[model samples]
Target: MDKENYTAWDSAEFLTDDDIIIEYLKAALEENDPAFFMKAIGNVARSKGMSTIAQETHLGRPSLYKALSGERDPRIGTVMKVLAALGIQLTIAPRQA
Candidate 1:
C-alpha cells in the first residue's frame, strides 16, 4: 500500500458515543495494565475535547496529557477527577474465580 493511500488511525475518532466509550474503557480494564487503562482514558478524553475535560477537571492541559500519557502512575484522586470529567463512574465488582 502506498503511504499516501492510508491515513493514520486514531481511536479517539471512533469514541464519539457514550456506550462505545464505556465499552472501550471496559476492554482496557480487562487488559490488567494500568498504563493501558490510562491511555484509554486519554483517548476518550481527547474524543470529548481535551479543553473541555481540563476545565471540568480543573487540571491544566499539559498536566492532563502527562498524567494520561501511560508513562507515569497517576494518583487515584487524579484518575477519579479525570473519570468524573469524562462522565464515567468507577464501580467495584467481585473478581471472577
Candidate 2:
C-alpha cells in the first residue's frame, strides 16, 4: 500500500452544509463526551474558516483555538459564542427514556 496514493480523510471537508453539520454535531453529542463535542465544534469551525469564526465571536484566533482544542474545558459562554458564530443553535428536548 502506497501511503501517498491515498489522501487523509478530514471530516471538516465533508461538513460543507448546514444539514451535514447538524447531523455531525448530533453524532458527536451522542458520544456523551464534552471533549468530543468540543473537538467536533473545532472541526466545524475549521471547515467554515477559523478566522471568520473568531472575528464573529469577538475572540482572538489563538483564544478560539485554545478553547476548542479539546484539551481544556471551555466556559459555557465561550461555547455559546462559538456555536453562534458557526450559525448553530442548541435546543432542548425530552430525552428518550
Candidate 3:
C-alpha cells in the first residue's frame, strides 16, 4: 500500500524549551549511543538557531551543521563548546551500578 504523503518527524519542532532540551539530552545520553547524543544535541541546536550557537561557539555554521548532522561523531571538545554556547555545562556523576 502506498501512502499519499506523510510529514517528516523533526525532534527540533518538539524540543522548544531549554530545560526540556537539557533533560532530553541527558536521557538520550543515558542510552550511551553517540549517534543518539548527537541527534539530541542537533535538536537543541535547531531549537536555538544554529547560526546563533555557531557564532557563540566561534564555529562556522557549516561546521556546526556537519558536526551535529547526526552522522558524524563530534569531538568531545566540540560538544563542550556547543554546550557552553547554549549556556549549559556538562557534569559527571557516578552512575548507580
RMSD values for the candidates in order, in angstroms, are: 1.5, 1.7, 1.7
How far residue 49's Cα lies from its native spot in candidate 1, in Å, is 0.5
Error of 2 at 85 (Å): 0.9
* lDDT by residue (tens digit), candidate 3, 19-69: 788889889899998887887888798889999999999999999989988
- Candidate closest to the true structure, highest lDDT: 1
Task: Please state the error at residue 86 of candidate 1 in Å.
Answer: 0.9
lDDT of 1 by residue, 10-95 (tens): 99999989999999999999999999999999999999999999999999999999999899899999999999998899999999
Indicate the worst ten consecutive residues by lDDT in candidate 2.
1-10
Give me the runs in candidate 1 sitting further than 4 Å from their true place. 1-4
Clashing pairs in 3: none
The residue pairs found clashing in candidate 2 are: none
Ranking by TM-score: 1, 2, 3
Comparing 1 and 2 by TM-score, which wins? 1
Task: Output the TM-score of candidate 1.
Answer: 0.93
Give the whole-model CA lDDT for all candidates, comma-separated: 0.95, 0.93, 0.88
